[model samples]
Target chain A: MRVLLVDDEEELVATLAERLEMRGITACWVTNHRAALEAVDRERFDIALLDVRLPEMNGLDLKRLIEAKQPTMKFIFLTGHGSEEDFNACSAESGREYYLIKPVQIDVLTAKLHEICAEQGDRQ
Target chain B: MNGSHGKVDTLGLDYFGRMTASISHEIKNGLAIINENAGLLGDLVALTDKGRPLDPARLETIAENIRRRVQHADDIVRRLNQFAHSVSGPVTTVTLREIVESTVALAHRIAAMKGIAFTFSQDDTIKVETIPFILQNMVWICLKNIFQRHDSDTNLTLDFAFQEIETDVVIVMNFSHEIDTAATKAAISEEGKPIILFLKAQIYNDQTNRTIQLRMPKKFID
Candidate 1:
């Protein structure tokens, strides 16, 4: 599946994209909201993985903006904050099944991504 | 300082929690990068075999990346430790430049998130005796107050100028726009009264010149 990774950490997002490509999944990454929007406008990405605590605009708000642009695109949030209050805030914005904490295991992340694709397949 | 005991308690707890959270978030971001880089190294080992040799250059690059992130995280932790020790004693003698620099270092991350930059004008630096924690908290609060009043401009900047007036040291926080007088007054008078009293400091809102001049005495006595 084609994926878009949005995170301010350049090395983290770039390395994740490289690894995803090695696993035969197409992934493109950007470091900010404006760049993320530009990438989406340029290409069709099935999934967008966003870091929740972005600099200018938080990832949840960016999710809304992207959803307006690409209604069919799905999202998965990545956050470094592990507090219950932070979790609740993010889950309240997106459903509970939609976020992964930082230092996330790649197997779990890819599993979730495939699960999302399968869910879409089921919907169709 | 009669009813201020409770205000101090509330403000201390509140500021302590927020500052810890912001700094910890920064540390976490650094850790996340290290995690991904290390995981990539393991991935490389798994993909290596007899026919296909592993690239030493790529491995070296990844190793270097991890080292850089470790140093980055170490620096953040050092800053956190510095902040924690700010309240180790009741009060201490410190330079005005040192106070501004330390507080700015702690706050620069939070400010950058909203695109705020602090410019310092240190013409003449003087020494003062004050509670380090309270003084830093006061400066941080004044920053928040300015942000609340003047964040309409997308490109926001706060300028800090230090001046000496006889026996007093005044650190003026200049703004990019003419701040709201009523809002600034209400915020300053109500929000940081405990801190103002604690540090024996006064916050004067110079709205005409778009500045908040924080005047503190050279000798602080409890």
Candidate 2:
């Protein structure tokens, strides 16, 4: 599956992108919301791994922008704060299963991707 | 002498607090990245011990990233230490380019948070004997103003140039986009006018000699 990863943390994004690519997933990484938006406009991605606290625009706003364009694009938000308010807001907007906290285990992230892909298939 | 002066002091304190907070956050984030990279290397070592070969390229990248972050952290700490000492005295011989670059680095997240592309374009060769902390405060105010007017997708660029006009160095911060009067008013009034007054006084002192012009375009966003 193809994935777009957006996070301001360059190191984290690189590691996560590498791990995903190692597992046979095509991951394109962008450091900010604007670039992510621009990336999506140019290419197609089956899913996006977004960091909640981004540079230009936060992940929540970027999620809305991305979802508006690709309604079927799967999302998994990665956040460092994991505040109750932020979690609750994401849950309300995109369901609780899509949000993951920092230091995310590679297995857990891959599992979530697999689950998202399975759900998408079922929906289709 | 009055509550106004108290508010002015408070505004200075607030600006200092914001700068320190952002500096600390950047340091912490840098350390966090280093920690994660180290952890990944540890994980790789364990995998290798289990007879699974890891990519040498991954190891190299991790080490390189850690080295770069360590250097970044050290630079920040050095700047912070110098800044603290500069706050000790009123005026000092300060490198304008260093202060500008450090300020932009410190304000990167804040500018990015507001969708403002904070930039520095200045001559490193220029050095000035000035009130270090007060000058930083002025730059901070200008940055805050630029961030206030930033749009969602806009990129705000700051250019710092030192011109040798006769016997003086004119430090100019060229910015894009029209200034919002209400935001400027609120920024000055809600906090305190002492900063602006301080800047004006400093400029006025050198008005016949040196000049500092902070210019902004009527409307532009990159």
Candidate 3:
């Protein structure tokens, strides 16, 4: 499965991608909102992991852009920002069921990704 | 600003609440890191179970990473605990030096990220009958404003000098880089007024109960 991860924290994103790769999942990573948009256009990803806070465009805005481009693509929010406000905002949308806080449990994410991918395939 | 009218008690509680929010965010972030690292390690265990030969070095690194995250979480909890105690008392004789030091320590990382150097000085001789929580919150808001407006290459310096004759402690908030002077001033006034107002309310509540006594100083040393 192809996965795209975006976060401004290079170390966190890099570490996360490496963990995903270790689990036999091929992942592409981007650091900014613009790069994420460009990546979504150029690549076919099964899932996208996005950070909520970005320099210009936030994750919610980027999610809208990616969803428009790839209607079938799955989205998960991976953020270090933990507030009741953030949680509520993230849960407001459907298809965005998975809101994982950083630093994530690789096992939990691995299972979630598999579940989402299988669910997507069944729906299709 | 309302603190100028001798209402510091209510402002103290508001300040405590804001600090609790920020510090809790910090602690929550730390916990998330630790959780993620442990999950990764658990994933590695699963790989081993599948007869996949995992790198011994990676295993060792993961162990070290978890230890580091635990230490980070501990530090955050410690800071939060100290901050909590600062608000437990309604009125106390607070040392200006300790308040200045703690405020600097609390805000230094945030300021540094904004490319602003957070600096402060202490006067051992300066002691004030003040609500420490309110004072710290006011100082933090000022620091946050300075850091928010600081240019990438400039440093924000906060100097404190106590006037012995006047019996007042003076804090100087200076910026090396210029920002929207009007906006920055407005932000300071806007964010700071509620906190000061709340502190005033608490002081009034305490006065009515006669639980503690508070005195208003006669001069402003800005």
Candidate 4:
């Protein structure tokens, strides 16, 4: 599956992209609002992994703009500042499958990515 | 800006919570990076089990990343510790530059949320005897007021410069919120008057230049 990873922490997202590539996922990463928007504008991504907090704009706001451009793209949020309780509350609205906290287990992330894509019947 | 013991107490708790939350968010980011670094190492190890040779340079890079991230987290904790200890005494001796830097560091995430940048510098450092926590809170309140007042079309950086005025320190803050000096000064006065009275800091507004200068004595006598 092709994925777009957006987070201000460059090394974290870059390494994640590398790992995803190793797992046969075509993933690209960006560090801020502008670049992430630009990437989605220029390239097609099946799913997006976004950090909830960004320096300049809310990641959810960025997600809306991206969704406008790529209406069918899937999403998973990764947050550092939020607690599991916060995630649970957000999950009630967004879904339990939609959020992951920092220090993610690779197995869990990979499985979630597959699950989300499989639900779309577009497993890659 | 209400001068009441209960109000100040509430404000202190609120400021403390904000600072703690900001510091923890920063530490969590550092931890997140370190997590990715460690996970990359695990990925490398898994490759080795499959008969793929490990690239020594890549291992070193991961190791270095972890090291650097650890130091980053440590520095964040250190600053938080210092900030926490700032309230250990009602009054203490501290360098004006150091306290201002600490205040700015703590306010960074708050500013980033507003897309506001800060530029601070001082050619000379002056030591002062004052209430560190209260002084920091006052400066932070003023900065927050500036952030709230900033309604310009573009993202703006607040410029702050410190000058020694004999026995006092003057922090000159410059920004481009508006050219209406009277209105800006009135807004600041409405919001920050109580803290200004408490700290005995005089504030000057220069509308033409778009600046607010806060001047306070170096020594606190209580």
Between prediction 2 and prediction 3, the one with superior DockQ is 3
Clashing pairs in 2: none
TM-score of chain A, model 3? 0.94
Q: Which has the greatest DockQ?
A: 1
Off by over 4 Å in 1: B1-4, B50-52, B150-153, B176-182
TM-score of chain A of each: 0.96, 0.96, 0.94, 0.90
Q: Kindly report which residue stretches of model 4 are placed more than 4 angstroms away from their true locations once superposed.
A: A83-89, A122-124, B1-4, B112-117, B149-155, B164-168, B176-188
TM-score of chain B of 4: 0.84
lDDT of 4 at A102: 83
Model 1, residue A12: distance off in Å is: 1.7
**What lDDT does candidate 2 reach at residue B192?**
36
Q: Where's the lowest-lDDT run of ten residues in candidate 3 chain B?
A: B204-213
**Candidate 3: pairs in clash:** A103-B32, A103-B33, A103-B36, A104-B36, B7-B200, B10-B198, B10-B199, B10-B202, B11-B198, B11-B199
- All candidates' chain B TM-scores are 0.88, 0.71, 0.65, 0.84
> Residue B115 in model 3: shift from native, Å?
6.5
Clashing residue pairs in candidate 1, if any? Answer: none
2 or 3, greater by TM-score: 3
Winner on lDDT (2 vs 4) = 4
The Cα error of candidate 4 at residue B15, in Å, is 1.3
Span of 10 residues, lowest total lDDT, candidate 1 chain B: B146-155
DockQ of each: 0.67, 0.30, 0.34, 0.60
Off by over 4 Å in 3: A7-12, A30-44, A53-57, A64-73, A79-84, A94-96, A101-107, A118-124, B1-10, B49-56, B90-97, B107-117, B120-129, B144-166, B194-222
Deviation (Å) of B155 in candidate 3: 10
Give candidate 2's whole-model lDDT: 0.70
